[model samples]
Target chain A: MGVVFETVVISFGILYRYNLFKREKERLAFELEINKTQTTLQLIATQEAERKRIAEDLHDALGGNLASIKMNIQNMAPGNTQLSTVVGLLDKASEDVRSISHNLMPPEFSETNLKDLLANYYNQLNNRGSVRFNFHTSGIDRRFNKIDELMIYRIVSELTNNILKHSHATEATIQLIYYEEYLEIMAEDNGVGIAPQISDGIGLKNIQSRVNYLGGKINIHSNSFGTTIIAMVNYKK
Target chain B: MGEKIQLVIADDHKLFIEGLQSILDNHPEVEIADIAENGKELLEIVRKKKPDVVLLDINMPVINGLEALKYLKREFGQIKVIMLSTYNEEHVVEKAKAQGANGYLLKNVNKADLIQTINLVHLGQSCFPYRLPAKQGLPGISDGFLEQSNITKREGEILQLIKTGLTNQQMSEQLHLSIYTVETHRKNIMQKLKLRNPAELMKFIISNNL
Candidate 1:
């Protein structure tokens, strides 16, 4: 009877220790998985930052010099007739180059207000200036964290570019408003709105991905009035 | 076509200044007298150069574009200033636009629009990249454009009358739209355009060439 009792006690102790070890192992595994995911995300973010910096450098430095050289070359033709023809050709070429440079990096993001940035961006793409751009904001002075600021900037800018390229919007409005705990950014356009299904354009996906990474809520609405995008991120101290 | 538009650039980034200089060096319509890297430089340039237009950046090393705007306006009454910024917050933008910028151009603006804006602004049109409601001296713009785009011709006329700096009731008396209707339209226009800050719309009207 004593031996049987001892055996039962021993078995229960062994089982309990085994279960404890298994639980700890599982917890560590989960932590490892989380750490790996975080590292991967950080790596991708760093790559994107480097890419943007390089693109900006090229646009500002290389693009400007090239435009100048091309213009000067067009002027160097000997005769008036030749100069006119060359200049005209050069003008087309320069415009094309400018467009390329514009796509490489959005220069307008540096502007102080969203109004001019969208207005300037849309106007450049729409030759006839048919798309009217409007922006309005009301609230206390709010400055977001650096990462949040950059993300918002990219989202608004990328959305505007998408509208210009795809939506055929004749007008766009961007609004920034602060609610209780979040900063909201709204971008809307008066153009052919998106259908129910979102496309696979890298731009849209990129935006969605970025918002997701930031743990922000993005709501997209499309109708006859046009497509409107609302993105909100919680303020982090 | 017009005299090279007198220009002042304010930014905190040295690289951006370099980039701008590279572009300005080749632009036919621009005459960049000097470039400042901060708000202080902007103020100093305003005193010395008194440029026809100042391209002010909102996020600066010191003081900021909004504050600089007040100073520039007080010191240089006739000079036109344009707010250049990265963030498109309407509140801050509206504030800058109202401060008497001749035009507001985005940084994403390409080489051509940059030149065109300066030329148009120099010619006395409030030059903006995209369309803005055309108002005369920002008078009724707050009520007319912001209130509603469904404005009847009479409402427009009345709004224009208001923009010449008229009182709401006075505008109501002028336009057949009941004083209530005029106020409603004004509110509607603002809502549709999402222009919550009338000062910003007013600023947009005053700064850019119409």
Candidate 2:
């Protein structure tokens, strides 16, 4: 009887230890997943910073050099046939460089308030392709914190990029409605609808994360006609 | 075009200044008197050259365009200043106008609009990008605009009267107020609407459908 009791106690101890180990392992796995997501987020932010730095370098260095070259070539005077052609080429190349750098880097946020940034982005989109862009703003003059502004800008830019890449549609509209307490953005594209079985891609996921970071909500409505994304955030938050 | 509009262009970007210089050099009615890299330099050149107009960029080293504009207005009120910029942020434009900038133009504007703006500024009329009707002056004194802009009820009444082509004297008579009070009201309306002069206020009244 004594031997049997001792064996039962040993068995209980083994079972208890196994369960504790299992629980700890599960907790560690969950933490690893969270850490992975956090790293991804940080990596993305760093990548954007890197892109901006590179873009600025390219613009300030290469673009400045190109402009100077063109100026020098033009300064050689109009009668020089060969130089004029080279000057013309340099001018075209400089313009291309400007466009590329602009695409790579964000606008000077300090210089432009939110409304101007949106209008400028819309104008750029309109210029880039056949898409007709209609940007409307109401009571959007008030400024927000820099982080909020940057996040909102990123959301808009990412959404627009998706539209330009995937939506073959010709017409799109972006609206910014500023309420007393909250700011809302609505972007609509008459593109091919999102597939029903399609999972959220990286772009959409990035937008979702940004909106979440801003303590906002985003709703995407898509059909055969097109897609519309509505996002709202409380400025106070 | 009687006397070509003499211009002093101020921009930090050397390439842009040169491009503008080349463009203006070809124009019959526009002459580039001098170019400055920044606002301080602009002031120095303006003091020497006394150009009829100064095309100023908003962002510059060693005193911004707006800062220089204030000084210029205080010292040399006769020289018309046009704010030329790549970005048309409405508030900045409004502030520039409030500082007595005669006009605003985008750098990307075609030669025709640029020339037209220069001429208009020279003629003592305010100018802005044609696409930006509201920035040139208040487009109209619409009820929505009044509410959005926080114009008082009395001010709204005055604005409406002004829109109807009522002179300050006529408004004083109609509203049963002193002419001095009416004049004060008119001045307040211009300040609130960011209109530089009576002509722009009139344009605003017509364009706004008010």
Candidate 3:
């Protein structure tokens, strides 16, 4: 009887030890995951800050100088054909700089809300007439925090750009649904769906990273007729 | 027309300001009353000099051109303001217009157009670029005519207005041009197109699909 009782006690002790080990392993994994997220967030923030600095330098220094050069050239010889050609080149250069800087850091990002920014972007795309884009929203009259808004904007931009470049889609739609606790984003396109092999492409990967940073879940559905992507992310009022 | 038009220029770039000054030196009608390096300096100078027109740069230090424009419009309602910036974005232009800017010109504006815009703005007229729709078929056909007839861009613009059957006075008002200038452009258009009269001009316009 004593031997049997000792066996039972030993088994219980072993079982308790195994459970503690498993719990510790899980805690370690969770800590590693948190560290990874923090590192990635820091990297992204640093990259954004660098981009903003470069954009400002480009706009303020290079753009201003180019404008000054054009003005001086025009003043030197108003109607000289050769100077006019140079001015044209300068204008193109200035435009390129402006576009590059604008893309790096949109000037309206700080001033305008997410909806306006997306609307402006969509309007520009529609005006190009290459791909028709429609945006729909519900319960989004209130603005989200800038960081969340920016992340969502990036996700949508990546999705639409992917569609425009690869999906061969003539029409696309982006819908936003805001709930009390979280927001849902759905991007749909009427085109050949994403190829299975290209599902893990850089664009989608970047979007996945953003969604993960936002602590969101994303699902992609693709078939011959079209592709639809849905992402849900929590937000604070 | 008798008194010289007083002007105050505001831009952060000294080189750009000097270039503008050199260009305006040839035009005796426009007198540079004062120059400001930024929006703050601009307000101070405007208050002291009371210039007739202010060439305000959109991007500036301390206070931006748009804000300065608002203050100017509210405090000194008589002073005319023109937004001179490299940014030709539609929203910026709309904001300037909404804030009572008399004219909006890109930084690459030629000397002739710059002087003319200032003069028009001083004459109580507004001058803004006519943004044609992106998908419009008119631009292509208009470009063909311009290339074939050696017509200047300003003439092309006037031709489009003429196609709409606008009178000389109406064209002047819409384009911020004097009636005499409108008549001159009309004569030049007729000469270039070899049209005898307004009827022939209309016929030419239809035949060319311009």
Candidate 4:
């Protein structure tokens, strides 16, 4: 009886320790994986930066040359029909290149107040069609560090575009509230709500990605009323 | 009749700075009031310029974008900020949003979108890619759904990590546990909370203001 009891106790101890050890190993691997993912993400960001740099170079360098060539061609050979046609084609191609380059690099953003820029677009939207828009500002105290404001402005604008295109709504509201500790951005619209059974969502996914990148939380409500996105961003300087 | 949208952009990249300047230079109304190379320079400029909007970057050289943003937001609560970055990391975006960025956008965003956001920000609007929140909640949160019966210390650790944006592998490495153990802990957490997936977890955090 005593030997049996001792054996039982020893086995339990062995099992507990084994489980603990296994858990430890798993944790180490998990950490490694997280590190790997972070590194991968960093690499991706670097790649994106490089791509933008190339686009910028192409725009300033190649774009300039192309524009100048078109100018020279136009100046020299309006009389030469063949040359004119060729130059016209080249000019069209150059315009396309410039557009593509601008798309890749995002030129106008860097120089403006991100919020104002977005608001201008919203104004345009409000002016153009029938979408009744209301934009409110609350947390107007804390201006972001370099390059931060543009990101915020762009994201808000994109959401508005999405709403205009997909929501098919007549009215939308955007609110920016600045809290003592963090910031909150709320956008809502009244239209036909999203279908209940959404399985393969791509736009929502993109929105999710952008929200995730901000390290913010987004709430999407698509009921009979419409779609609402309320995002909360924690302030971590 | 349009409000003068006061603005500032802070970044270290000279080429991008120049490009932005050249483009906005054409906009007769939209003026580039002030531009800085890094976070510190940006802070000083903002202090002086007092623009209504400030565009900040994430990864700067001296103090980094996040830190600078934190400082600025704390000091100037009225100025709106939008975080700009080339990468699209969810957690980073979340962090920026949390830290009070009025908006978030990718560097590869459209020029029209960029202009539109400035207007949006000026108009006092906020935007981001939207996602659902997590469902299952804190240990003692609301509906008594979580087991709350006999959760181990390890289980609690795993929950905290999950809330902090750490993946399963990250939890394992941080806690010195095996992948299997972390997975098991996750299972146990879900089972206890009666939660389904990560979305649920996120929801719970938001509902509880975690």
Candidate 5:
């Protein structure tokens, strides 16, 4: 009886130790995943800060110099044909540089008119002729915090960019539906769909992280017929 | 002319200052009263020259643009300030506006807009070149929120000293206060800013562009 009781206690001890180790392993795995996501988000934030710095430099330093040069030329020769030609060329160069800088750093976040911002964003895509975009919005009359607006803008922008790059379909649609509790964003492309075994590339990861940053939910539906990404984020007012 | 618009252009970049001078060279109603490399010198020149308009850069070596604006408007209310910033971060703009800045213009503004904005500000019209979205209602530095929080001037000074890596003893010496007084001020600042510790305070400062 004593030997049997001792053996039973040993087995129970072994079982408890194994369960503890397994739980620890699972916790560590979960922690590693969280850390990876955090690192990716930090990287994206750093990239944005760097881009803003560079864009501002380009817009201020080089663009300011060009404007000063144009001013000097205008002051030097108001009606001279040659100077006018140079000014015209300078004007074109200035516009091109401005567009590039603006693209790098989207317009200031305080632009209150969502419709206007969307219009400008879509108009910018006119340079890329192959992609046809249809944008629609509803129930978006209320204002959102600046950070929230920027995040939403970035998500839509990235999703549209992905569709343009990966989707073979010539047409895409982006919709923003605002409800009392949350804002729903949808991007759909009628082209080749994402594969099931596809790894999370930088683009998808960026979208996911952005959605995570906004404390939102994301759903993706992909098949041979088409692909669509739907994200819902609360207005962090 | 009856009187040229007296202008003091304060920027750390000498070349940019020169470029701005050249742009304003032939203007009929504007004159370059002085050029300052930093906020300290800008304040000195403002005191001496009493310029009608001060074109101040946001990023400077000693004392940033927002602080200078605060001091300038507080000391010389007649002098109009137009902030010249390379980037239009919304918080910075809102802060400048709240600090009594007469106008805000991008550093890359064309000569025409720059001149017009300066003239407008000189004539006592507030101007903001960038469009802030309507309805978001982001608070400014001196917004009602700050007023409600009741952060004192001493606390603000201490917060700035903390940001500059000044120890309590050093801050006390700089501000002509006792070390304990400086410590009290620091504690109050943290409380007013709703920061739990130094790390949180620093994060708050960076995030808020303070």
Candidate 6:
């Protein structure tokens, strides 16, 4: 009886130790994951800041100089063919700068709502006419935080870009359903679905990271017909 | 009636402002009151001088043109404000109009048009080159929507091309029409439908199954 009791106590000690070790391992893993996410979020913020700075420099500095040049050239010679040609080239360069800057950083989010922003972007895509894009939104009359809106915008852009590049899709639709606490983004396209191998590509990965950053989960449903992506992000005002 | 139009120009770009100043100096009917480098200074100058016209740049430091326009219109409603912007965006133009701007002119406005617009605004006339904002509310796409809207068959074809994301140049190449002709058709379609921009046009097309 004494030997049996001692053995039982020893066994309990071993089990407790094993449980403690397992908990420690899980804690370390959680810490590592958190550290990794922090680093990634910092990187994303830095990238956005850099992009914004570059866009501003291109728009204000280069754009202003180009406009001044055009104005000067026009003032110097109202209709001189040589000067007119130079002016035409200047206009083209200005347009290039504008587009590049706009792509780098869209117009101020404080100035326009997300729906208009998305609509404008889709309109631009439709101008390419490769795919017919439709955007529908409900319960988005109110605005979200700037960062949240920008992230959502990027997600949609990335998804559409993927479609434009690979999906061979003729029709695509992006729908935003806003609830009280969370926003659901559903992007669907009618084309050859994303292959399993291609699903691991950088585009989708970028989207995944963005969704993760937004504290959201993304589910991708792909088959021979097309692909549909749904991401739900919980947001705070 | 013989008074020279007193003008205060506000812009952040020194070179562009100088170029504009020289152009305006050539006009005998216009007189320079002062120049402000930003919207804040613009308001200050306008307060002191009470200029007849304020040529405000949309993008400026310290305070933006739109905000200053609001202040100017409220404090000194008599001072005519002409938005001198590099952007010809329809929304921006619409915002300016809604904010009580007397006129809207592109930064690259020619000497003749610039002078004409300023004079016209000073004389209590509103000048805007772009089409006015259409009525709010999307028209439902019924079966006879196109017919009711008077969209022509050629216009319909162009609309289809536009839906396919074809640029005017590409459509011209494919359809054997000049870019100008394609643009005309597009404009006519938008006017008939009373759609403001391509996005609305696309939305209408998709909703109507056109």
Q: All candidates' TM-scores? A: 0.51, 0.57, 0.71, 0.42, 0.56, 0.72
Off by over 4 Å in 1: A1-30, A33-37, A108-130, A190-192, A196-201, B1-210
Off by over 4 Å in 2: A1-108, A123-129, A134-143, A177-184, A195-199, A232-237, B1-7, B13-35, B83-100, B103-128, B132-210
RMSD of each: 13.4, 15.1, 18.3, 18.6, 19.8, 11.0
Across A1-237, the per-residue lDDT of candidate 2 in tens digits comes to 999999999999999999999999999999998898688668767877887788767765676567545544554466789886776687677667766776776546655677877776676566557776666666645657765677788888888887887777787767676766777776777778666654388888989998887778887777666776878888864
Ranking by DockQ: 6, 3, 5, 1, 2, 4
Q: Report the lDDT tens digits of candidate 3 across residue range A1-237.
A: 999999999999999999999999999999999999789878887887888789888887888888888888888876789999998999899988887887777664766667766766676678665887766555644546666677788898889889989998887768676655877777867788889889999999999989988889888877776776878888854
- Fnat score for model 5: 0.13
Per-candidate DockQ values are 0.06, 0.04, 0.11, 0.02, 0.06, 0.13
**Candidate 3 global lDDT:** 0.81
After TM-score superposition, the amount by which residue A19's alpha carbon in candidate 6 deviates from its true location, in angstroms, is 3.8
Summarize candidate 6's per-residue lDDT along B29-129 as a digit string, tens digits.
Answer: 99888999998998879889889999999889999999999999999999999998766555677789999999998776666788899899999999997
For model 4, what is the alpha-carbon lDDT of residue A158?
Answer: 62
State the number of backbone clashes in model 3. Answer: 0
Is model 1 an incorrect, acceptable, medium or high docking prediction? incorrect
Question: What is the iRMSD of the candidate numbered 6?
Answer: 10.9
Off by over 4 Å in 4: A5-9, A22-26, A29-33, A77-103, A108-113, A116-137, A141-154, A168-173, A189-200, A223-226, B1-210
lDDT of 1 by residue, B167-190 (tens): 778875554334544454455345
Model 3 residue A31 CA deviation (Å) reads 4.6
lDDT of 5 by residue, A1-237 (tens): 999999999999999999999999999999999998788768767877888888778876777677657656665655689987887888777777776787677645364456557755665564445876766665644557655676778888889878877888777767676666788776767778776555377888888988998889888777675676778888765
